[model samples]
Target: MSGPIRLWVAVKHGVDVVLARADRSTGTVAMDRAPRKTSDFDRNAVEEAVRIREKLGGTVTALTVGPPTSKEALRDALALGADEAVLITDPARPDLDGRGVARALAAYARTHPGFDLWFFGEGSTDHFTGTIGPRVAAEIGAPSLSYARRVSVEDGAVLVEREYEHELEKVRAAFPAIITVGQEINQPRVPTFMSTLKASKKEIRSFGPSELGVQPSDWAPLARRDRVFVPEVNRKRQAVSGADPATTARGLVDALRREGVLP
Candidate 1:
């Protein structure tokens, strides 16, 4: 709180799903050939970090563990208000699994103790696994705060609120903790043209696992995807016909009951 706090946030550069195709034969989606942009939810993460920096004196550094294109996501974060950015890339495995991504981030954490706060969206806009924050917490040996809807800094600690069923749960942890925030935490502000231009000059640092003294054997994927396929839909299109509206309504009700649509 005394000195400028270093804030690190994860940004996801994702492709537009409009071109998403499920290969029935391969049982996988064609991802490499799709258009990309900064994920919608990740913008909220950067927004929250910028908000914290605005209220409290600090600097925000955007972090992304992704392919080379992920720099677009980091630039988006910078324009929104991050002071700097870091890109962790592995050409061998461009699309890293959740645990692998967490390991890389944790390795970065080991080298960069200057980060007082690290932020992530509850889940990426594409894959909503909701596990990276906890995984990073385990890798870095820091406390994990998940599903945060409301957040604040108090006495050099992060105070968080999250939804639990019909109620809201509150929790807090000291600085240098990992927090995964839900989209409800804050509304993202649109960066002005001037701010966008200023962001272009901010430094975007790059790193690889080797630089952190991390060996390929050091990080293993916690999970892997076999394939992705769209399930076939079966629908019964039946019509209820009658001379009057009330009769048609009754007929529809009968048809629903007969089909077991209503119990």
Candidate 2:
């Protein structure tokens, strides 16, 4: 293999299997909860990058921006066959939105040049904001394509296909472009026991805003959260007492009609 490509795969660690809360007072979504694995779409992105690297003979570097506890996602990436992992942790950036996170990642990418491609998921499962990859690419002045369902490289160029509401689109772009993979892009591979153990021992590079040459003043608020609150669970059950089956049936129909379940 010749002309080995350097691939950077972005992953995210979000709240564990719990419903996201929107702060009603501050409009900020609260993320201070137990950390979980990488986003499902992001796992596909990492797996796609790893597969590309395996075919093209290159290095796959997994990068994530989150709290210190986000290292778990990096370890999982390593277990999935990434060559290296980088975790960007900044206490001041605890509530970073897509734009802020993109700025940081763009700066990191600028510092480490010679990467042939940048890969990310279409969106994070928790936030569901499909903006980071495009934002990072714009900040770095690189061309980008999002929602890619299939991708292949040929003659130093990338061929990709994506779906629109009513159309299927195909794109061919040069190297050093950013691409966001959708769930349909590829199925993520499960890690073996040995791979898991090896990933646990892998060295993860950590950085902060200062290390990335980003000042607090340089950061701009792209999105704002007003408050965070758990949604109230409604589990009221109604019981109807009836003496006959016909009466019970009539009651049930009445209840369904009242709830607009039937006309």
lDDT string, candidate 1, 160-235, tens digits: 8899789878888888888888778888999999889988888888888788778866666667676556676687
Candidate 1: deviation at residue 182, Å? 0.8
The TM-scores, one per candidate, come to: 0.84, 0.83
Q: What C-alpha lDDT values do all the predictions have?
A: 0.83, 0.84
Top candidate when judged by TM-score against the true structure: 1
Note each model's CA RMSD in angstroms: 3.2, 3.8
Task: Give candidate 1 regions above 4 Å deviation.
Answer: 23-27, 220-222, 235-263
- Show the colliding residue pairs in model 1: none
Q: Per-residue lDDT of 130-228 in model 2, one digit per residue for the tens?
A: 989998988999999999999998877899999999999999999889999999999999999999999999999988888888886555666776545
